[model samples]
Target: MKLQVAIDRVSLGYAVNLAEKLDSYVDIVEFGTSIVKDYGLIEIGHHRPAFKHAELLLDLKTFDEGPYEFEKGFDAQADILTVMGAAGADTLAGVHKVAQNRGGDLFIDLMETGTDKIAQISGFTDAIYGIHHSHDAVAGFDAVATVADFHEQFPNVKRISVAGGIDLPTAERLAKQGIAESVIVGSKIIKTADPVAAAKKFMEVIK
Candidate 1:
């Protein structure tokens, strides 16, 4: 399982610094929703905080204007862009198609979406279906259990990713459970004293 480090709620300079250190260790470097909304995508390119090894996944969490948001995101050099699962089927399909056509990855954040909605959008073969537990929600997450349930519920949706309070033991357990394609981490990895060391520990544990 791949680890994606999410950097959020920080200044551009601090984000860049953390990103630079984390670039080689993690599989994906995510500029969380706060970063994009705070600085705007256009400004990100101007700084050109390059990702040497890892792919850049921007957590746009887009709900509407699929094409417009995707276009701007791609222009800003985002390798993978996110869209909300709560969005209309037409909206998800539109962004999924756009993302496919561009040879980029689209992640459908299954945050607060009903099972019916998940069933509706679960047919996109190549698009990654993310089983997301909201950060705002009070309930703690069980990554392995949620992923197993998601896979059991939507067996046809092959590509799966998940996020929410992931830790070393949970990450390794998830990997051993053998479901998620990638695991996204935020504070557990990014909030440590040495993020690189923390990420390395996760990698070792998962391996």
Candidate 2:
């Protein structure tokens, strides 16, 4: 299980600093949707903060105009980009093609999507299917249980990633469960007093 630390709701300068600090510690550093919406892709592309070790993921949460959004995200130098699972099949195909053509990865955000919808789009064998929980939801999430259920339902889907409010204990459990390819952590790692230490702790536990 890989550690993907998400940076969100912070200034671009601060996010860049955090990314630089965490580049070597984590496997992937994500610029959450807020970053893209607050500062457009053009700005991100121009800045192009260098990450020496970790890959960069832009959570575009693309709902439509897949080609345009994906092209811009890849141009901005994102190693991976996300599109909504609820998007139209054509839209999903568009972004998947862009990711393939650019030699990047596409993550389908499965927040609020049903099993039937997932089955319909499961043909994108190479894309990472992200079993995500909505950030705005009031309910809590059980990461392990969710991953188990998803795997049972869609056994053919080879790559799976999960994101919610994952803690160190949950991350460790996920690693042991051995289903999810990657686990995405946010405030638990980033909001702490010593983010590097927090991130390292997660890395240690997952290993």
Candidate 3:
């Protein structure tokens, strides 16, 4: 399993610094949507860390103007860019092509999507399908059960990633379950006093 650490709602310098520190230890470093919104893609690109090991993911959460947004994200040096599953078929197809042409990866965030929609979009064999829970939602999430259900429903969809309130125990459970390719942890790591040490702890469990 890969550990993807999300850095959100912080200054650009701090986020970059954290990412640089965790670069060698983790599989992916994510610049959360808040980071992108706080500091535009131009500034982010100009100051992006030279990741020697991990891939960089920018949570664009793109809902429209698929090709344009994806192109810009790739230019900003994102190895993987996300689009909401709630987007239209045309929009999904557009971004898929853009990612293919640019040789980048597409992550479809199934945040509030229905079963039928997931079934429809499951044909995108190369894209990573993320089983996500809304951060704003008040309910709790069972990461292992959720991933198992998603896998049972869409067995053909490989490269699964899960996110939402994952901690050390949850991360270990998800790793042993072996359904998700990546487990995303945000505040559990970033909100800690020492993010690098926290990230190392998560990396140990996930490994």
Candidate 4:
């Protein structure tokens, strides 16, 4: 299991500093949707977070104009970029090709996508299928159980990742379950008094 720390709702400089501090400890550092929206790709591209150890993921959430968006994201130094599963097949395919050509990874965000949609896109063997719950949803998420169910439904679709209010305990559970390739934690790691300590705690548990 790999720990992916998401930095959001803060100034880009602070996010970059936090990412640099946690780079050696975490596997991936994500600039969440808020940051991408608040700061356009052109600005983010110019000031890409310089992470030496951890991979950088920008939640571009490309719903349309897949190729253009992905091309810019890669140009902006994103190691992995996301596209919604609900996007058209052509859109997904276009971005997938861009990622492949750029030698980067594509993360398909399966937020609010049904089984039929998942089945349709499961053929993208190299893409990481992210089981994400909406941040605005009122319900709680059972990360392990959801992973197990997704695995059962699509056994051939490897490289699973999950994100939605994951705490240390839930991260440990997901690690033990051994289904998800990576678990994403946002506020639990970023909103704490000591973010590095909190991140280290999560890494220890997952390890």
Write candidate 3's Cα lDDT for 62-81 as tens digits. 99999999999999999999
Give residue 87's error in model 4 in angstroms.
0.8
- TM-score per prediction, in order, is 0.97, 0.99, 0.98, 0.98
Weakest 10 consecutive residues, lDDT, candidate 3?
41-50
Local lDDT at 116 for model 4: 99
- TM-score for candidate 4: 0.98
How many residue pairs clash per model?
0, 0, 0, 0
Instruction: Give lDDT tens digits, candidate 1, residues 1-207.
Output: 888889999998888888888888889889999999999989976764677898888899999999888988888888999999999988898898889778899999999999998998888898888888899989898888889888899999988998998888899999898888999989997788898999899888776
Q: Identify the runs in model 2 with alpha carbons over 4 angstroms from their true place.
A: none
Query: Tens digit of lDDT per residue, candidate 4, span 1-207?
Result: 999999999988898889989999999999998999999788888888777789999999999999999999999999999999999999999999999999999999999889999999999999999999899999998888999999999999999999999998999999999999999999999999999999999999999
Sort by lDDT, top down from the best: 3, 4, 2, 1
**Over 4 Å off in model 1, which ranges?**
none
